[model samples]
Each structure stands twice: as structure tokens, then as C-alpha cells.
Target: MNGIEAPNRLAELRQAAALTQQEVAERVGVPVSAGQVSRWERGEQAPSLRYRHRLAAVFGVGVADLGIPSAPLPRQRSSAEDWFVSDEQDPRVTKSQDEWRRTRALLNQNRHSLSQVAADLYPEHRLAGTGLIAGGGWIPEQPVDLARIELSEVPDAPEPVLSGGEREAARMLPDQTLTRSYDRYTRAVRDLAPPRLFEDRVSWRLLDVDWSAGAGRMSFGDTTYFNAVDVFEPCAHELAYVALDADGGLAAHPHMRDLPYRKLIGSPFDFARRPVMPAISTLTIRRGAGDDVSFLLHRRDPRAVAAAGGMLQVIPSGIFQPSSLMPAGRAADFDLWRNIQREFSEELLGMPECDGHGRPVDYTSGPFAVLDQARADGRLTVHCLGVALDALTLVGEILTVLVVDAPVFDSLAADFVERNDEGTVVAERFPFTEGGVRGLLDSGSVAPAGAGCLELAWRWRDVLL
Candidate 1:
């Protein structure tokens, strides 16, 4: 039989020590001929385990340092999926549908426990779990005239229908989120990171808002949170892309860390029950002749994952930013109005003069100009209908009710089609009744923000229709 082949440091060590094969054999107590040594050097023969140690000792090295190839070690678990422990005869077997359902139920039952575990495990991250205290101490400088609509009368949410995979993905989200506090009295947020895009800012004191009432409020207090900027590495945008690519979920991109911090944990940015972040929802109502009021509605593009694919929403809705509103220290109290105008200009009118992303663009035809002319002609009137919070996302909405006539609606819609080239918006039309709003909600296609907008709009049905 041929000699077993193996790579060893016999040749290199012998040369370095200025010793011959015979010398090494004598040192190791191996009764082998020099011809056998030559064969071993050529990987034509290997020594026994005991002899390997003796040979290593003579070479002033360990057996592993001899450069011999050993059997591969077992593959280590290093991904988020690795944390999902499984018990089965075949470890590679995929989970069944019933098993996934059971997994989801178990996760929900132990959500608080898991959150606590996460908090304890990542103390450096400052995770507060479900119990957090935020937003106390601060007062409003000036009174806000916006009418607060009571959402207590709103119906309870229907049971959600989610796939097994979707439920599992949702279980992976964190119980905390990010918030930016501008002093103890005011908590602020920007649409973009680095937060240096705009100059004017509006601030409301934390103590001014009442948190006892749900959904509609000027301020909120909840702190079980963490900064997305801290937990997500490289950038949050890259993390967003990966979440969309893999699970259609919004997750923080995890990176490899040093020992003891070796695991790549997903971020708790989107899923956290943090402080309420502000957004603007404008309901453009067109009154035709007598009492006929038709409200404008738009469908989001299917490619937009933020809305969970395509969904029906108001004509123009966007988050409020300190940079975009309150610029040059003028009209600071009118920040909500300014945000609504910008949303209209970008989403409905399709004007390139304004932008959603932080790119610098001048407003050639601003929203105020339309508001001014409409007010002058007595055809359009905008009213602030208060703020509401989303239960699932924890984001607050500033509802702006716009009353417009048919001529103005037609003019704006025509302008939107002409100015639009990018398919950011798929379609637009007028839905005149509360039934339309209810239909979208029942379809389970409207996003949480969109659903909030519809609820606020429904409250104005008496005047709208």
C-alpha cells in the first residue's frame, strides 16, 4: 500500500536547525531510515500522533504549528437566524406552518421578557425595553389654535392578517426607538441625519402636552428608546435597504464587533415604542356647486416599502422637519402649515423646486402662494384639525383640513399630471364619501399614517360633504 500523505514542517525545521534526517530521527527516537525521512518530507508518509508530538518538540513548535492540514472544524453560527434555536431530528429541516404560528404566539407571550433580555445583554446600547420615562418639563411659548379632534370614538382595529414569515419578522423588531430632545422641554426630529439642512426651528415645551389622552396631542412622553444613529453602523439608509431586500422589514443593519460583542443584533429603531415624531397629513376637499364635497386621494407606488407596498392615502402627506419649516426665524408657529404646503408641492403638484430627500432645491411656486390666492378668492380655506398618534408605529400626525372648490382641484390635478415624470405617485382621484375612507381601511392596504389621516378626515364629514 502507498504511504499515507500529510504536510509537516520536517523539511523546513531540519534545514533551520542545520540537522540531517538521521539526526532528527535520533532526537525523536523514531527508528526510520533517511529514505523514509525524504518520503515524509515529500508528504508520501506521516508520523503517528505520538511521533508528531516528539517531532514538534524537537522542532521547538506545537503539532498544529507544523503546518499540517487537519480536519475542518464545525461551522459556527454567526447570523440573526442563528439565534432562532431549533430542536429536530434533522437540524436542517425547515419549520412547518403550525410551528411558525406557535413560534409567533410564544414570542408575543414572552415579548417583555425578551426585551428585558435584550436590554440586559446590550447595556452599552442603553435599551430601556418597554418601560421608559421621557418628555417631562417644558412649556409651550405660544398657544396653538389647532382644533383637537377626539379619537376616543374611533373604532378598535380589526385583527391583522399576516403570513407566517411576516409574523416571525415582526417578532424580531425591538421594543425601543430613537428620539432627539432639544433640552428637557422639547423633543425634535429631522427627516435627514446630521440635522443641519435647515435654519428655522419651532419648539414646544414637554410639560405643555397631555399624554393621558391617546392619539391626538401636541406632545408625547415615552422613552423606552435608543438612538438609531448609535445602534446602526455605516448608516441607517444602508440598513433600510438591506431590511427591504431581505424581509421587507425596517431593521438596523448589524455589524461585526470585537469579542463578547460578537453577535450582529438587528436595530430597535423602527419597532421601538419611543416618543411621538411629527408628520403632516393634508385632506384636500373640493366643494362643487351646492353641498357636493369630493376629497382627493392618492395611491402609493408599489415599490414603496414604507407603506408595505402600494396603499391608498391622502393626496399629500409627509413628516415635519425643523429644517424645512421655521426657516429664517419667520413664521415659527406656522411650521405645520409650511410642512403641509411643501408636501402638496412635492407629492401632488410634482414640482421639482422642492424635495423630500435633503437635496437643496428652491421653491419656485411655493404652497403659500396657492394658499394666499385661494384665501384671497374665498375658494380655499385650510384648517388645522389637531394631532393624532399611531398605536403601532408611535408616530404622531398633524391633520390639516383643506377646503377647495372644483375649479381649484381641477387646476391642481392637471398641473400635477403635466409636471410629473417620475412615477413616485401611481394615480390620483376624488373620493367623496366616508365610505371611501372606510373601504381603504377595510382593505388593510392603507398605512398606519394613512389610516390616521382618514380617521381625522371622517370627523369633518359634516362640513366636507
Candidate 2:
């Protein structure tokens, strides 16, 4: 065994045995403190081999039963210490670590300037006021009718073809980069538990987008979450570092020179060379008659999430995925509105996450049913403003807006939470005025996709309001 499964039921077992932390510590026959035992139970720390064996014996169970590996714990490197253990001591690991550090520093220093580079790269897709790029003609000027947007799943979607240079660059990438990146994330956010890298979790990969006949059509295929983390995330980091470098830019960056796929940064619509998994980002608004319009924003906790940490984003943003792994669940969740509803439940209502391993969700009843009825009665309106790729990450975003009548919003507001799994919601709603919206766009802390959605929503105020 290597790393132990997360969130061990040590507390449960201790209670079942009718023992306190101090009692358990004494039974271990070592200098263990109650505090140390508490850490072990909470998964904040792991026990040594001797402690593991002693604790298992004290609990009257095998090491494996206590969520402790039977094998000796591997020696940890301080620089790359993480919950997930890596036994390799290769030079490539050190190189990857150095590269990650450099990239992280560059991003921190040049965070505000990223939008300029994005506009320069994809001038055609860049929105007029914001630094976001909309593909497939899903621009704010031409709002997509919710009825015309179509999403179809393609189980046998062909894999994207990589050019010779892209393949070579991929080969040159260090195997330990991804692990080391996750380690860095864990270290930065020590208070929050690290996220499990579910490599097998199915995600909807955008195969293609078409808008030739005045209707929006998007085709999707299934891809693993780890695939995006492995390929796109690092690529985005390296590209950002290279593009923002003042010394020599792309020509001078050592890693950028090897990564020919960096050229694809400008081509937002070319899904042939890489996978593009979009997150559904909705700008939720509460509106009444004249002057009674307010929007919600989320301040993402830097210590909680790996991406877009400490940034302002539209409320209720999440990846486009099914609630359950069943085929029926996937078919039922293929709608844009369903994905948004799930996000609203999780991010707004503080509901438990639907992580795609449970039973299929029944959309005919519960809160989902209430939302459906509201939409049917014209008390709720949902519209797709467009789809945009982030300037820094190149991660796709399905930009949308949800407008609910003041009465409906007030009823739901009773259950609204101040914080969720991702971060804190700005408790006070901001008025949907031109000045307020422009201030947020200029704040420099807003995520590109969020800014784009806000801009589009403001543009369509006449219709949306």
C-alpha cells in the first residue's frame, strides 16, 4: 500500500471502542499525545510505521483496517511533501519542481497583465470591453436563444491528433510535473484538505462547436478529469510564463521552445490538437421591475481550490458533468440548465456534491422540479450568452445568465449560504448598474470568463430584465 484512503473513520472506531484520544494514546504504549491522535483522525497527518502498528494493535485491528499501509512509510522530501507519496528520486523530479516554482512566481507577479496577451493572441474572439474570447459566434452582441442551444454526447468521438512537434514536446515533459504541481497546491493551502485526483472521473470533452445555421450546436465526448489536469493545466501554466516573460518571451523560455503546441494558444476553436473541457459559468441575477436588479459573485478561496484561487467569478460555476455514472444519468444531465442547477445547489445552497458515482438524479421532483416549474411559468429565465476560453488557462467556459423574479429569489435566499466547498459568496448583492459592472470588470481580480459573462449580461439588459 502507498497513500492511505482519505478521511479514515478513526473517530468512529475510537467511539465504538469507548475510548478517548488520551486513552487511545496511552494504549499505544508510546509517547503519543492526544493532539497527535486527533491529527491522525482528521487526516492532517500520518503516523510513522511504529505508531501505525501500535495504534492498530491498540484498536484491536490490522494496519490496513485502520487505513494505514502495512508497508514501511517512504522517506519524504521536504520540498515535495504531500499526502500522495512518491518514491522516485530522479533528477527529472527536481527539474519539474523548479519549473513549477518559476511558473507559479511568474503568474503571481503578472496576473493582471494576462488579459492583454489573450486579446493579442485571439483578437477575433475578444469581447469589446472585457478580455475574454467567445468562440462559435456566441458573443454578447448575439445572444444564443436557450431553445436553440443543442448538446449531443458522442461516446466514440475521435481522439485529437497531435503534430510531430506536439508529440515530441509531450515526450519531453517530466513525468513528475503533475504530482509536484499538486504537492505545491497542498503546501500552499495547508488548512484545507487536498483534493483527490480522481483520474477515472468522467468529464464532458468538447469535441466541436458549430453555429452555421443561426443555431448553437456543441458535440461532446467523455474524457477523464486527469487527462485535462495532465495535458491542459500545465500547458496553460507554461504558456503563461513564456508569454509574459519580459526578457525574451516565447523565443527565450527554455520550456516554451520545446512545446510547439504553445502556438495553439491563439487558436481557440481548434479542438483537434487538444481536449477542451468547459465549465458552465452562470451569472445569476435577482430582478423585479425598475431598479431592482442585483447579481451575485463568488470570491474563490485560495486555500481551497487549485485553479482561479483568490479570484472573483460568477456565481454557481462548475464543470459540465453528470451527477451519476449511470448512462441514464448522463443522458438526463446533458442539458445546460441541469448542470447550472447542480452548481446552484452545491455552490449556493451548500448542498453535498454530486460526484458522479451515486444513483441518477431524478429531475422531476425536489428543488430541480421547483426550478423547472419557475422556468415554465416565466418566473425564471436562463440564457446562454456565449462560450469563452480563459485568457490564462485556455480552459473553456459556457457563459450563461439566470434571472429570477424578486419574489422567487427572496424565497430561495432563505436557504442561501455564506460559504460553500469552493469559497465565500459576497453576502451583499451588487446593483446591476453600468458603473458597478464596469468597476468589477476593471477590478483586475475578476476571472476572464466571469468578466465576459457580466459584460454580455449587461449588454442584453433590455431583453433579460
By lDDT, the best candidate is 2
Query: What is the C-alpha local distance difference test score of each model?
Result: 0.42, 0.68
Residue pairs with colliding backbones in model 1 are 176-272, 200-326, 215-389
Give the alpha carbon lDDT tens digit for every residue of 152-260 in model 1.
2112322212111232222223211222112210011111111112222232211113423322344322121122112211121222323232323324323323211
Task: Give the Cα-based TM-score of candidate 2 against the true structure.
Answer: 0.73
In model 1, how large is the Cα lDDT of residue 255? 32
The residue pairs that clash in candidate 2, if any, are: none
Candidate 1, after superposition: displacement of residue 265 in Å?
A: 19
Over 42-109, each residue of candidate 2 has an lDDT whose tens digit, in order, gives 76666754355456545545445787443434444222123335533355554454454445445534
Q: Estimate each model's TM-score.
A: 0.44, 0.73
Lowest lDDT sum, 10 consecutive residues, model 1, at 185-194
